[model samples]
Target: MSHRQYAVTHTDIEKLNARLLSISLSRDERDWQSVFHTHHFTELFFVVSGEGNFLFREKLYHIKTGDLVIIPPYMEHTEQSIPDTPLEYYVIGVDGISFQPAGEQTCVQVFCNVSNKALVEEIFSQMLYEMRNPAYGSDKICQDLLEILILRIIRSQHVIPVPIASTYMTKECARIKEYLDSNYSEPITLDTLTDLTHMNKYYMAHSFAKYTGKSPIQYLNDRRMQAACTLLRDTDHSISAISASVGFSSQSYFTQAFRKKYGMTPIRYRQSQAGDDAANGS
Candidate 1:
């Protein structure tokens, strides 16, 4: 028998300092709604099946099976499914690490039709199983699996993982942003936000605006409007129904806001979108 020994070097296997925050499998059924949100940690979104669109940076990116999207911290994003073709996917949240592609300053990256689809699916499946059925050392197992996942992603996708530094202000802003994103439909005011963040209203507003460029109320309204646009484009819901669904109690007020944002009434905006789709044979 012939044997060859290979010497290992420290640079060959650098230590990864990332930690797993959370993981969940998601399925979007009919009329499912997704809100634009941000996280203080890096998020890896792996599409398992069905077709959908990923909304990021004010643009829509078509995502389907085998698509992997890496969202860096503090980036606003959301995902929506097609009418009948609902989206099923896994979201893996990892703290202390972010991805950066070579020669790019932006941290966001999307890899379509990944080469190792089967392996990626297996990793996620095993992680989900472990999460659902925990035992001794399961948490440690999950963390190790997360490291493998990150390493595989980096190797296969040719991206670099950078460590993230969390600050008090950044964490606070992220918390408030996440709260607003998940609960935008609820009635909220300055007092509500103050209570949530436990900071003076003016200071909280200033800090949030400094990070997000929009005041708390403005951000809430914009988030509502974004959801409204999605509903108008994808669903046949009535203006009144859509308005109420997205937090506006008054159809007239919703219409006015929509017009101001889009330079057209809600109905007209829908018609224009339809016209555009037909013209493009979508």
Candidate 2:
């Protein structure tokens, strides 16, 4: 379903909370920091114009057109427009993150090294395209591509220390979040996370919960539901098919979970979107 079609009960449009999606135009002469706030979603800012620095997690990082700044869940961050140009970008907040253990670990790093700016540009370009000519599943595909770009940011960044936590585990946490983001389709257990972090399972889970507010399993399930919602709205796929696709083992269980979180059955939600689309003459 189109993200706009979701019956969002609590969307923070200034920084789209929960389901990572936003687009904004910037005035050419404005610059400042946003009111600092924590979100329950991960954010991606793809600058469309101007230059700036994002103050995130007590570290200042530079930004510009085509640059991406990722603010993970519960991380306090904001934008600072550069001297000459005002900052603008298509911003999106996805529901969860995954960690990839193999990459050069970075904690709150900005990605300026572009071996492939063209690829990053193309991803944002496609976002513009989808917004203009939305097809079946286009929103879902755009969000997936956004996920890829954020993953690239996590993998290709250089580490900079933030004051919230001591130890290299901060970097380790970033890697684990990236890993979880990439591997969300698979089963994630304490053993899986422990092996990835090279720490004790109980200790690692506690630390993750301490920093990220949700246990690893809770994070994964939330991501799965985010994916499931997109699928149910976009594809003709059955509820059972989507449940399995997002790693839920049972249709009934998925339905129960979906209703609890979104306040409607999957089928009913899809039908509602269909009704709205028809009413809008789309």
Using all chains and alpha carbons, the TM-scores for the candidates as numbered come to 0.62, 0.46
- Please count the clashing residue pairs in each candidate, in the order shown: 0, 16
Cα deviation of 58, candidate 2, in Å: 24
Candidate 1 to truth, TM: 0.62
| The 10-residue segment with the lowest total lDDT in model 2 | 159-168
For residues 1-282, write the lDDT of model 2, one tens digit per residue. 655555659734222122335543344455343765655444556776788777753357777766766565556567777776777676665563422223424233344555576787777778767877889998787776765665556457643323222212365666676677668878778788888889877878777766665788887787788778778778899988998989887889989998998899999999998898899998
Model 1 Cα shift for residue 253 (angstroms): 25
What do the candidate models score in CA lDDT, each in turn?
Answer: 0.84, 0.66
For model 1, how does the per-residue alpha-carbon lDDT over 108-227 read when each residue is reduced to its tens digit?
655645898989988988899999999998999999999898888888878877767522136667788888888988888989988887889999998888656689989999999988
Cα lDDT of candidate 1 equals 0.84
Best of the candidates, TM-score: 1
Error of 2 at 271 (Å): 1.3
Give the top-scoring candidate (lDDT).
1
